[model samples]
Target: MTRRARGLSLLLLLALIGGLTALLWPAPPPIFQTRTMPLPGVLAARCDEFTPRVEEPAEGVFVAIGYDLANTIVLRTSAGNVVVDPGMDLARAALARDALLARSPGPVLAIIYTHSHIDHVGGARAWISDGPPPQIWATDAFTGHFIKQYEALRAAESRRGEHQFGRSVGPELLPCTALGPTPDLDHAGSTGARMPTHTFSGLQTLRFGDTEIELHEAHGETHDQLFVWIPARSVLLPGDNYYAAFPNLYTIRGTSPRPVRAWIDSLDRMRRLAPEHLIPSHTLPLRGRDTIAAALTDYRDAIAWVLAEVLRGANAGRDVDSLAASIGLPPQLADKPALTELYGQIDWSVRAIYGAELGWFDERPEQLYPQQDAAAREVAMMGGPPALLREVEAALARDEPRWALHLLAKLRAAGSPDPSPELNIRALQTLGEQTHNSNGRAYLLEAAIRLRRPVAPFAVAVDDELRAGLPIDLFFAAMGARLMPERAGAAHESISVHFRDTDDHYVVTVRRGVAEVVRGEPLPGTPTPLASITTDTDTWKRLALEQDSAAWALLGDHLDVDGSLLDLRRFLAYFRRGA
Candidate 1:
């Protein structure tokens, strides 16, 4: 126990601790700030519990299939078999049919829908058997949601709309705080169900032989949703009222805001039932009464906690961004398996819930007023896009990448075919290559970098991101991105210019027609052109969008023209239908 001996002992202990730390320490690698191709999806359905296994069906009655993200639920009885929320009818209908057959060979008795989501009801095709058919069930909203499939998809579609939401999640944007269940590949069978045949309101229970089923209607995930509970077995089937992962308070694609308070209360109602097992329509089932109940309780608290924090922060005058960043799960609950951000993030959910309860505006005057176009103002201030590109290039040279990136977006907006003396549409290709955040919007923005989508022959859609996250009404977004509304009022002209390879850069001029090339500036005394243009990228987009006849009038005077009538036809055709 001498001082020198103690010091040596401490050093030995430190070494041991270091070795243990290396073994146990877990942290994600350094974050990447840029977005790239092959963008990410929001959430994968958690099916760890349903790993291919077989248990003898309970005599008299057996529940053959459990629900997952893709399909609905189908249960079996000695007399007959019933299906709920059958999946996509056209594509995977057979798979769902086979799953039901595997469960039991019995007559098709009845069909029910917990709610009327497509996943809940997409597989109606399989229900057509040789015998008496199953009936369909759903809420009144079921019919409306069915008709508005395109609109309802906006929530799921945000997974694709990378550009508008800036969901081009890079390393940094990945959910790093906690990891949810990542499933192994090789899962098969009708874990996915089909659309329902019969829908109802309030609570309805049916006893198929000994099969006692209760379907209760609630509003949270969707407008008309029914959760099923089996009092006999202490097993409850709550539609999306509780996804194994956190329920989405607000989906990113878009939807009417769900009630946060209702969502919390609904989750609470399930916990109190204390089922021996709880089955989610989309995720794995919960085993054991205590575990199932506890998970559901924590879920209730998680929702409540987020809502409380969000409302508290909003009442305290915190802005949306500030509130979003501040609101998160309590640490004790954060580690819970069921409380993870698989389908939904606490931050987005909190902000969305807060906005839903309140309004989007934070009562700030600066947010209300008209705002100048950031691109046009910058282009004019910097003497045009040429100077802007020069500045961006200089930043790149100095290794100021963040600044280069910030400026790149502005330059792109400015270069929208500026047809003036200071025209420059360069820097995009280089920026696209060096970009980060491989999410969907980033890909389109990168494509916007080239003024055209990446050359199709060279670039097949690398992933869904190329088209994902694109506005559902992208014709409108394309108009905005490529438009200069003020100057181009009713000004349409089309002329072909044989852009010649010039001394320094390409020069385009009207050869035989009269049309104005917009978003570009005229350069004096240039011999050859690299690319010819009768109209600029934006004007072409605008006139094409408007289908303005004035475009033909501009073609009357041609400053430059080349190729045959067929080529012109082809060009026009390409403009009408995006390549």
Candidate 2:
């Protein structure tokens, strides 16, 4: 065949193949397609006074309630009233309803929620006029999970809150930062959630006041998220995932670690519909599908970018601090208004990702082999409660309150059933005073108080005993972020901690407010002969952290494991915590 004929034939074949490809692998669905998400004109454009356009919302008036971090949509129709998201605050909900009535025509017929977060539920009271409120709509599991997070974070915050938001009661505490565009009555670390009273699942559409609203389940930021679409207005409310920021890959304020994958998919859902306008609660509204889609896509990409990079570091065995420092969004994402790093930054988010994906392991050889603090201390001659007390004094003289803290620790570990409890208390108080950061102050203060706070002996209070001696991992993880090279030891430990999972793991066998690792176990889980030298988490922490293993054995217990006394000798040769 001639060259021209051959080229024509190839072109025909290529055209057929292209047609097949288009059918087989169509372009992904646009985020705006979820519903004809409208522009922020009638409602958002005038969100300031931020109040309503009219004195009373009449039938056909759609009012948006400010739900703190979420938005609740309310519709006033001739058939009572219909509301979505009820909002996060009752007062906000009332204001929104009042504003809608001011502008529109009737009463609320029904109320709907996009998800189960407390911010979404805060405004239910606003819908309730006299007796029963509008039927509350939510995922079946929404209320349960909402309550669970509420309880967990509520308790964990009191102790762990400072690290999350860096707030405390004293002068040493850092002033609250402008974490977001607007300030909140409830601090970042604190909870202002109220559980939702209703629940639902799957697709649910309701017709009221001449308008119909469609609700679809979208699991993105939270498990029980509900994405609503109004076909009439072409509006899509993507909730938190499609927010005007990098989407908080990890909320620094500390909630359940979100599913990085789930978040991406949610954005994809929003992307498919290609909504014309996007109105999220936290930031100003967005117009044009191209802009909103770009924002949502970039938001997804930003979170994905951070997650992938942080995972790369985690895979490379990087510590939390290094991983945090390494995470940064790309230019495409960094400049997007919706992808701003307003609320939660990538650093802490990366660490939370690390915690979620890879717990406490860096997979390095040093980590595989942990130094036995109690055993090493026994090998060293750093005993004598009084000598440690003297060392504490010396450290204090040098203005190294941290070093002084260590010496006092040794004295406490020596378990001198003497009047020196007063000395330990004083050392802790002094260290607490010297701490500059909120995290450091709270942690050191808590640690010192735990040590000095009078309590029964170890045998009597096994839990307290075990607690007095914190594990190396936990200890480092706590003080890890607050590391001052001159004061604290290495953030990462190349030590192996082998402990019996059962026997009061949290307590370190305290006797008369003294930490005693009375319960011991073999290094290797062997059925071999009698070896009463079981190391506890605390003893291991001290031996690994403070170089006081030898002293620990004197005050505690010790015995050679699988390698016999010879292996202990290897540890003795490499041991360095003791000075």
Candidate 3:
């Protein structure tokens, strides 16, 4: 028990602990390895559908398919040509326009937009002839719906859209987009877009030249979607409703809840029409009334059945995953070519429906608050990152790519890069190649590519024409979304924006943690703002998107600042480019 003896004993104990720690330490993750597999055969077959050709199913009706993600249909008549859903951008639309002109030549009297999706309407200008501009048509809800999407979520959707469409990946990874070839976004400028000059609700019939068409407001893929019905020819143009694939009840790219019930109703309504010639905005047209009817019937039933099963499962207290795994299309529907999961998978639909109806809570108390840190601690307790990496490899070998991905994700989150991104890339590629759903495959492959090479965040281009159409409110909303509370800190300030062109005024007040936007002039009793901005919509958009520097804009007189330049810069600093 002497002091010297005690010190020697402590040193011996410390050495013993060190030796045990060394003995129990985990091995490093396996050397990064992967086995490349051929892409699925079904996907290749699906790609063949987008072969870039124009087909005429009915007299005076020319459809330019495979030219873009969506088809451009030309309804030729004595009066003029009526263009429907004009492809994605100017370049593609111009090609389609020339093809239609070669076959059925005439000035485009009217350009009918089946929906407000950019793909459907971005090529508006290309369809117009060298005469007075055509009257653009769309559902009344189109503008509001489109604006809502751009409000605060534009940047997020832009990034997700890139993945969903395989923007960065090569053709070997993604032969074609699920709907068609990847959209020509590079040439997709606002110059081609034309807002609806004529908006309608419910149903409206137009009789021009020898064509009599009915525009029925059918809510399906989008709230503002409509179907163009040619009564004289018994031709029905269902926009994104009945493609030759399982309907995308849920798109991998994030979206607001698709109204499944409304979608079913829309299909049923189409069935009642009993059109002999059915031309979808994507894919080839179908002939024969019975064949078209049968396809429409099966498509609707599949959707209805999935929705019912999801609801039934939710009511029975089953979790979302269980419902997604169990619910699938009946064999009769699944066997049908039109109902194949080429574009949309049934399981994604099931989860989407379940989540849309009942929020994210899975009813499991443990899931209420995620235990990410706890999971990392547990991983450390269970032989650490090396053991988890081994499990990931085992899962990959066993054809459980999803499980492998899960393990790899946990390892990455635990701050262990030993396994390397190569393992994650392999798992993602495996999943991507195996899945029949083209969108899913594109997203997976793009994600894998991202792990290998990080790219700049995708941002939707805003041209002058597009900027003019966008409301000032959207800029404010995006500002709020990009506001960094930490950057604001204890700063409490207010800035008023006045759009000279639109003659609109708005006020933005930034507190410590939140940014509040108010339309119109500030209340009478409110304190004066720190800065007041006077600029047109385009200049503001440029500043907001980081396309133009605020200091440069101010110097160029694009922006007129009433307050101190330093204060203006500080106010602008609170909002980052993208989240």
Instruction: Give per-residue CA lDDT, model 3, range 201-247, as digits (tens).
Output: 99999977877999999999999999999998999999988898888
What TM-score does structure 3 among the candidates reach? 0.88
The most accurate candidate by lDDT is 3
lDDT of 2 at 335: 64
Please give the TM-score that candidate 2 achieves against the real structure: 0.51
RMSD of each: 21.7, 24.1, 13.5
Q: Cα lDDT for residue 399, model 2?
A: 64
Task: Kindly report which residue stretches of model 2 are placed more than 4 angstroms away from their true locations once superposed.
Answer: 1-71, 76-80, 150-154, 158-198, 314-321, 368-579
Candidate numbers sorted by TM-score from highest down: 3, 1, 2
- Tell me the lDDT of model 1 at 52: 32
- Candidate number with the higher lDDT (2 or 3): 3
Q: Rate the local accuracy (lDDT) of all candidates.
A: 0.48, 0.47, 0.76
**Candidate 1 lDDT score at position 45:** 26
Task: Assess every candidate by TM-score.
Answer: 0.56, 0.51, 0.88
Model 1 residue 235 distance off true place after TM-score fit, in angstroms: 1.2
Model 2, position 512, has a per-residue lDDT of 23
- Expressed as tens digits, the lDDT of each residue in 448-526 for candidate 2 is 4445332111101112322342223333222111222332122221112245443432212212222222224423322
- Model 3 spans with C-alpha error above 4 angstroms: 1-36, 185-191, 369-372, 458-463, 523-526, 537-559
